[model samples]
Target: MSDIPLEHVHREPDSDTGNAVFVLHGRGADEQDLLPVADRLPGDRHIVSFRAPDRLRGGYTWYDLDLSGGGLESSQPDPDGFRRSLDMVAESIDAAVDAYDLDSDSLGLLGFSQGAITSLSLVLERPDTFAWVAAHHGYLAESHADRSPDGIEGKPVFVAAGAADQIIPASRSEAAAEGMREAGADVTFGTFEGGHGIGPDELEAVQAFVEEHD
Candidate 1:
């Protein structure tokens, strides 16, 4: 894993509750860019936002992939990069749990775009590490799908996507949802009327899921 430093933003909801939501930002964005989204969520829910590990030409990147080929193919997701990011995030979760004396069963993750892909991968890679994962407009890497047959049997998952999205097409998102379902995760998938970015309806759905799971 790359030894990268991270910037974090946190919000503690209740002094007695240990439940927390770990938020991951989208591409070309930092922790500060997405922390404001927390304002729309429950004020009482503990929120933690983490910046990406790598600084690209203009922004940040969690992993590397080729987009010049017209269609995303033969691209590599930096395992070391994701490893570092996961370590940082995992440490943050542990600290939150300890600081709040939280029940291990109440920890959740919220990720958007590239963040969503990372969040979903982390939960799958370490099946028992999290209670739930909220994936917003991201799909699983195709390479990861057939590598293992094991699914997150007990973990709850919420996936929100835009039907008109051209960047990551709705078909791709649906396919990921199907894969998760076949893998035994309790999945909740929703599609909105927009494209690429999350809209009000999607946010509302995410808020409800977080509240119910958290």
Candidate 2:
């Protein structure tokens, strides 16, 4: 769209209900990376996936990871880059709302790894902006600490983690759930037996969650 600066690819719903599920890919991936994942989700809503602005390796990254000390497991998001990506994503969503005639109240989010962290940060500070969220193999970042669990009570959120994940440990995802639960979000935290990537079980569970809420 002319008003939207972010590069995105969308899949139209079979039947539009003015609803949408915005899918965010992990670092080193682009909008197209998550289209298959979105297709598997059960919803009669538009699917949108966006490319992160910063290019790295052979793909895109939402923010840089500072792995100087404890490495990827304990690394933190670069404040400046994270903030910029956040603002740009917000702008994209606003433009999408106007361009697609979407119902803002029916918007949901699905993300993986770095994308999950970004998604969680976005919704945590502004819970009312989205209806539900599903984060896979990702955790909550310490940078954006504006969590108001009370204001987000009864909100549905599904959190999936890999028991053997090395990149962003399962413990981090558990902690993310704890934080969201405090925020009064109806969280579904699931730990599958695997590594950093989403597995079949995780996909099935997430699909079920989206279906239940849809």
Among these predicted structures, which one has the highest lDDT? Answer: 2
Per-candidate TM-scores read 0.83, 0.95
lDDT of 1 by residue, 147-186 (tens): 3335488568888888898777777677777777777888
List model 2 lDDT by residue over 76-195, tens digit each.
888899899888888898888788888999999899998999898888867787889999988888865447744588888999999999988999999999888887789999999999
Which residue pairs come into collision in candidate 1?
none
In model 2, the runs with Cα more than 4 Å from the true position are: none
Best by TM-score: 2
TM-score of 1: 0.83
